[model samples]
Target: MEQLMEYLLHYVWQHRLYGLAPLATTDGQAVDVIDPGVHNLVNSGPDFFNAKVKINGMLWAGNVEVHERSSDWFRHHHDTDAAYNNVVLHIVSAADAEVRTADGKQLPQMVLSVPDYLQHNYQALIDEETYPPCYRIIPHVPPLTVHNWLSRLTVERLESKTDRVQQYLHRTGGDWERAFFITLARNFGFGTNAQAFEQWALTIDPQQIGKHRDDVFQVEAFFMGQAGLLDDTLVKAERRDSYYMRLKSEYAFLQHKFGLTPISHAQWRFGRLRPQNFPHVRLSQLARLYSERRADFSLLTETSSLDALRALFRIGVTNYWRTHYAFGEESRESDKTLQTSSLNLLLINTVSPLLFACGRQRMDEDLAERAFALLEQLPAERNYITRCWERAGIKAAHAADSQALIQLRQHYCDGKDCLRCQFGALYLKQGRS
Candidate 1:
């Protein structure tokens, strides 16, 4: 599932529901059918009208090309009645032979005629292994439409973020301080390192660490000690040894100063990652960020972009980390810069949602917009869910569609509740009328 999310965005974007023909009365009055082609008219779903659609003055709707055999509709028991009665159209991408309704009514069948434009667009997105469709799709999307769509998406993204933050507030019994600590911890490693960081925080006592803020060294010691970097004397053989030794003594003094509990054997992994990304270093940086910036959660609402958020988090590492990755000083340059990508992930996963959550509480539009603008500039995400649609022959034209597809899949397809998705229902109504 973790791996799938990494590439699902692109797949879902391509499979987005295109528009369907709207229902109409013989006298031209619009009639809402069991399933309307609402999304299709918006160019967001399969291009068929629906079951029970009137073609050439005759009411017709039935399945087109759902994967199973025609009889499977009966096997799935659509023959049992209501599903059959409203079906005016039948659509299929492929068919073994002709199909009919359970009552022996001859249904109008329509095979999908995926536009050449759609096919070409889809093929272009999936062929490359690196650099997702963003670069390619960006050129094709109209600049005007891009801005308009992003403006809307930015709002939607922020609203969603705000909702999550509210829930966190409730879950934590409305303690802003605890929430801030959690938020800081979450930002420590961004997405990939977030869970580990959270676990590290959970194992350490917050009260013990909170009291030592006056001496920033004590705060640094608590975090490093909690991270288990001060355990071995042999670890001192490296240049970082001196730094860790000082931090260990400082933490010991601070722990006694504030009755702090020592950290246990918490799991931290450095394998397959660059040295700069080590959990120990990241935890140190996180502590430093908090010590340097003493603002309430609401202060972040004022930040305009992910870069601004990064600037907030960019407290220089302790004197030790400046010279060494673990405990050894290096002759060569070790990357001390916080990764922008990691910060972006923090905005996407933690900051944006939390900011939006805060905005909802205060009903602040500025906070919402600020959080959303950060998301808009992020490169379009690609994932398995998006690829499935790409394989099915639709293409993502922009980040707006990609995010929408992700939302659709997470909220609709995975739930097997197409009725909730305007696009999915439109697709099913046409594709499996």
Candidate 2:
């Protein structure tokens, strides 16, 4: 007998992928599968429920329990469990032994073997080295299939982010502005220091920052101070840099007044990051946005154009950041402006989702449609997932396509959960009726 997972048997039974001729119980009663029942996604009591079958010309309807072998019914104690009493049939790959209900009634049993091609195809997915084990078939897949699945995946990706947005709202006491602040802050970390940025965002009193929001310098003080970046060590290192001294001194006074505590400076990551992306610089740029642009939540809900949203995040860093990547280290004066590409990323990862979430919360379909429209208009994001998809005979044309590809990579490819993936399902169903 071939080694098998019970899930594969469930897949076989649910899809009616078994010997086409006929089936019989252990006692040789003629059998026919009417319906295999719904597969229990929650993995509850029964493997499947509401099944219908015919045995010895009698119609029976109830739950179904599948196992690699009928003996597992006993090994798992289902024989004595009342949950199995309603099972009209026990389907297994092997009929190792008989199964009886808790009331001592023998249940009908049928042996179902996996089609050799299906097992071979599934094993190739599991054993293949490259991602998307179905790479070979991607080009040949119907274009309509690819389009529809990607469309569904893009919405799924957006919905998943909406949950995180709701979490931020819960943390902010239903304050949309503060929730947006935290979400945008996390994205400012640009992947490496995102967690640290989110942690820092939670530490600040958004109202207190709002009070001093007019002064960009004070905003920098609050931002850097809460990030735990304005230390005495920085003051000492940049003793001659008056900018560093001013931020540190102002932060101390504000910290005492607001009863604020900062996240450990160690939380910010610097290794392998460019000077422009350093936490210190990004934090400064964000501070400028708060004081100058104020990036109101209303902007996201009302703003729909790619250009308009990009302009919103284009708030450049103050002069201090224009010359320094770190507290003490003064580098050549650079523009220090948020690049168009980085702006696009912030729009894709932060703004669009924020808009969609606002729509969902407000029950305004227009805002949600605007969110989708934004991605459709923007260029595709260049990232590992998109690159891999490009290599596998598909290329993303815009942010929507790229976002779907990203969802596919994270939710399916990474987990090898191809059994649930639309593309994976198509790949498996190839050549089958």
Best by TM-score: 2
lDDT of 2 at 209: 85
Q: Going through the candidates in order, what is the number of backbone clashes in each?
A: 46, 0
Candidate 2 residue pairs in backbone clash: none
- What TM-score, to 2 decimals, does candidate 2 have? 0.89
Which candidate has the top score in lDDT? 2
lDDT of 1 by residue, 362-431 (tens): 7887765555555666655567856765554445454445565566556445544333333332232332
Q: Residue-wise lDDT of candidate 2 within 62-141, one digit each (tens)?
A: 99988898899999999889877899998888888988999999988888777777777777787899866889899888
* C-alpha root-mean-square deviation, each candidate: 9.9, 2.9
lDDT of each: 0.54, 0.85
- Model 2: lDDT equals 0.85
The regions of model 2 sitting more than 4 angstroms off are 1-4, 24-35, 42-45, 49-63, 71-90, 97-109, 233-240, 430-433
